[model samples]
Target: MREVFQQELREVQDRLVEIAELVAISIDKATRAFNESDVSLAEEVIAEDPRIDQATVALDELAITILARQQPVARDLRIVVSALRISASLERMGDLSTHISQLARYRFPDKVVPKSLRSTFAEMGALDVEIANKLTSLLRSEDVQLAEEIRNEDDKVDALHLSVFDKVLGEKWKGEAVDTVDATLASRYHERFADHAVAIAKMVQYLATGDWDQSAA
Candidate 1:
């Protein structure tokens, strides 16, 4: 029975890592769609979001089953609880990717980001994908240092988000109202995606150290 319970725990971890990978792909494709103004690619990203969501839901149910059947105690209990939280964070990250893709799709033919801000959005997208990949590593390895690194990457995303605002609101800004709205929403989605990655890393850190830090999330 003990071995079986342990196997279930391992399965949960594996599923979480799988979910992270899907989110990474979603963001990567979404970024490409946005950059190229490729409506088809954006549609693909949007269409696949349901897979991430369904996987997260299934993982949550499995975790809940383990909690009930195994009645996990101490560290085991922590693992189950944290798995649930991490799954939720991963799902939210996937949703953010979908949101970014939606912006690209909505603009169709024309670019969602104005030419002046394309480079900035491109950089933000790259950072988002980098942070997501790091998140997958952190989940699999549970390395606290990697968690810290993910947080640092999130800080870069935050800085980029602020820069977008500065550019849009600057006196030299010439974009139409739709352009301003699209840039703001797209930057926000990328920033929030990083935020979810950081949150998952914090959950992993708490699982490893048994020290929960709300501020980090």
Candidate 2:
């Protein structure tokens, strides 16, 4: 890669990292909005989503321009293509978080999510945070091993998602109606946010090892 192409690619990479960080914070805030029923926080998450969306679009355009002008090959090509796809996923994850936040407004603020399902949501929130941290680590360390570990890390979020469903249904089975269905739907959104982080990890792994794995889906 020429110096100019390398410089452009670096700029795209940095912008993508910015998008990831913003979306990660959005996910965290959205999860809290659901758990605590804080409409202000949910609204904030929704409001900030456009930042991620715009960043993704700008970064993608720059990347595409680089691909057209430079015609990079091998590692340089992988980095640009991977970053483009990663940015798209991050933007979608931001949208998912905003969707979750919107759902929390379906009911009154005083209403609490069922006690049986709260723990699972709490766990999912922590896992989402951890998954975000892991992606940050991958960027810093370029650790393929750590990136691969992210797939396993995502399973923890999946488990939490499943457990929330189980708890909600189990409570419903015990004659407790699901009055707060919003949180249940919100839990799935958080779970998908973690899933996007896993997609980034898979791309990171491919960047390092050139192995294609559809299992991240």
Candidate 3:
């Protein structure tokens, strides 16, 4: 029984790594679609989002089954619980990537943001992609240093998010109302993607350090 339970726990970690890999691919493609106005890539991201959703649902069910069968305690319990929360965050990150692609699809041949803000959005998108990739590594290796790096990148995303607002609200702004709305939504999507990555990193860090404070979440 002990051997079987340990195997189940390893399975949980493996599934998480799989889901994180999907999220990394998602953000990569979504950001490219957003930057290049590639409707086909955008469509791909939207279509594949269901896979991320399904993966998360399956992981949640597996975690619940482990909880019921093994009645995990102490660190074992934390592993199962954190897996659930981390899966949720990864799913949200996937959704945000879909949202970014949706914006690109909506804009179609037209760029999502005006020339003035394109570079900023591009920078934010790159940071989000980097964060997602780092998150996947952190999950697989349990490297707490990656978690801090994720947080730092998230701060950069937040700064860019605010800059988007500042530009749109500034008197010099010349974009149409539609452009304003699109820029705001896209920036938000990018920022939130990084935020979810940070959340997952914190959960992983806490799990590794045995500092399982609920507040770490």
Per-prediction TM-score to the true structure, in the order listed? 0.97, 0.89, 0.97
- Per-residue lDDT tens digits for candidate 2, residues 148-173, read 67788888888878877776666454
Model 1 Cα lDDT, one tens digit per residue, 1-217: 8999999999999999999999999999999999999999999999999999999999999999999899999899988988988888889998899999999888999999888899999999999999989988988899899999988988988999999999999998999999999999999999999988888888899888978898755
Candidate 3 matches the true fold with a TM-score of 0.97
Candidate 1 clashes between residue pairs 3 or more apart in a chain or in different chains: none
In candidate 3, stretches whose alpha carbon ends up further than 4 angstroms from where it belongs are: 212-215
Instruction: Report the C-alpha lDDT of model 3 over 1-217, residue by residue, as the tens digit.
Output: 8999999998999999999999999999999999999999999999999999999999999999999999999888988999999999999999999999999999999989999898998899899989989988999899999999999999999999999999999999999999999998999899888888888888999989976657657
- Which of candidates 1 and 2 reaches a greater TM-score? 1
lDDT of each: 0.92, 0.78, 0.93
- Model 2 reaches what TM-score against the true structure? 0.89
Best of the candidates, lDDT:
3
